[model samples]
Structures are given as C-alpha cells and as structure tokens.
Target: MEYIHGRTGDQILGSTSIPAERKGVYQYMATAIQKLLRIPIPPELPPPPPPSALNNDVFRLVMFLDTEAPRIYQNADQLELHLNTIFITAHDICFTELLYLHMGSIYEQLKGLSNEPMVFCYGDIHPGNFIINDDGHITIIDFSETSILPSSFARYAIVSTSKLSRG
Candidate 1:
C-alpha cells in the first residue's frame, strides 16, 4: 500500500485498499483492548494511588494532548508552537498545585522511577485504523500500535479521546 501526504501535509497511508488484511488486524486489536479494559488493573503494576493521586490521571492526560497535538494538526508548524506553550503553561500550573498537596512523598516515589520509568499505554488506538460499527461502538484495528510506558499511560488516561498525530 502506497502512502502519501494528507491534507495536513502528513504522510499517511490514507487508503490501503486492502480491507481484508486490515480488517483482520483490526479485529484482533479490538478483542485485545476489550480484554485489557475489562481486566482489573494488576496490583503490582503501578504504585498505589494516594488521595492526591486522583488528579494524576488528569495530569497525565494533559501531557498526552501536548505530545499528540503536533501530529494531528493540519499546519504542524503553526500548531506546534501553540501546543508547546500550552503544555509548558499547563505543566507549570499542574506542578504548582501539586507541590502543595504533600507531594514530597509522591515526588520521592517517582524520582527513582525516572531512571526506570514505568508507564501503561494502549499504544496504537488511532482513528484511521479504527472503526465504529452499527452498534455505535468503536473498534481498534491494530495491535502493533499499542504500548505502555509510565509517562505515556499517564498521558493516555488523561487524553483518552485524543487522535494520534497521523504520519
């Protein structure tokens, strides 16, 4: 399948013209996500949530939005600057608020994690490779795209609906 530049000037394989193969991949991905979403989060995966950690998910989301905006924008150059500004400013605000909430302990816990970060992610979940069936439920088509990292997982949960920047 040949890929070309999209209206956004991004090189995306807009139409693969290979529905059968793509459909198979999609079916597999949808089933996986469905299973993962239903499974209870494993106990040893992430650190237990502190009372203040309720907002951590939101914090992760904003970061994900910042990371993804550049990819989805039609005018990447123009949107990049704006997204960077928003990310920085939002992060500043986020830290400012979080610092006051007995975050010292939290930071300590996360500090060691910097060297070996752990994130949970539903890696691919992009719109182009996904479809909504007659039942109006969305299905993911590619499992090759999903991944988990501590930072990224935080971002996804926050920006769960954000589109991946098409490439």
Candidate 2:
C-alpha cells in the first residue's frame, strides 16, 4: 500500500514538474521525495531497447522481475510471497461465470496463435501495475500469477488476444 503511493507513474513522471534550471535539484529531490515517503528506489536499470518481438518483451519483463526478487526477498522461498491476498474459496457465481467466458475467449485466441513463435507470460500486464522509467526501462510487478508456459506466438502473445483481455 505504501509503495504504491511513491511509484505511481504520476510520481516519477512528475519529477519533470521541478523547474528545468533545477534538474540537479530535482534529481536529489526525487530521491528525497521517495525517501521522505519511505519508498525504496527501484532497481537501477539500463535503457530499454526498442520494441521487439513479444517473446523478447515477456522475457525482458521476467528478467527484470527476477533481478528485483532477490533484493526484495531475503530468501528463495520468500519470493513466492504475496503483498495483497484474497482467494475465492467459494467463488461468486457471477464472477466465476464472467471469468469463464473471458477464459474461453482467451483460450480460443491463444490456440490460434499457438503455432507461432512467442514467449510465455502470466495473463496480466497492465502499465499501471508495471513501472517504466524515462530510460525506457520497464519492470513487471504483481507477480501473484506469473509463469513461463509454452507458446509459439512470440514467447508471450502480443497485444492481439491477451491484449484485448487486458482492456
């Protein structure tokens, strides 16, 4: 909850709000803002490459997460921890039905792309949940359900089928 307040796109992007003459001041101020708010600096990163194949995108995302996990986790098993958790032991009927409908649609679309080369991905990929720096670097967050499933449509399927589901 606390982390969210500091890393929102608005917060980082808003660094530009500082006067141009005070770029150096803004840099330190940004760090101070994060510190004052108790927000940890995100992992240092190299610039992101130009958009490439979907497989590469997903792989890049996973690599980013994998890199961060150790700093965020004290041990290997702890990597599986969830920051916010809720389970539908007795799933709501409407929610279940809606999810089923969506899943079916997603399945059909994935099947069509199964023959292509692609990267594996956990189903969700929203920008708000993910973070990108001005360097063009991006990181994956909310790994409650991430994996490397087999696929042919570019490691992870591009914004075609899964992308629509994201919207």
Top candidate on lDDT is 1
Each prediction's whole-model lDDT (CA): 0.37, 0.33
Regions of model 2 farther than 4 Å from truth: 1-118, 152-167
Across 1-167, the per-residue lDDT of candidate 1 in tens digits comes to 34322221011224455667455445644564556555443334456531111222222133333533223332223333443455355544333322222225323212222232334345555446545443434444444433333332334432333332422
Instruction: Give the lDDT of residue 67 in candidate 2.
Output: 22
- Which residue runs does candidate 1 get wrong by more than 4 Å? 1-38, 43-120, 151-167
Model 1 / residue 71 / CA error / Å: 24
Single out the weakest 10-residue window by summed lDDT for candidate 1. Answer: 4-13
- The window of 10 residues in a row where model 2 has the poorest summed lDDT is 78-87
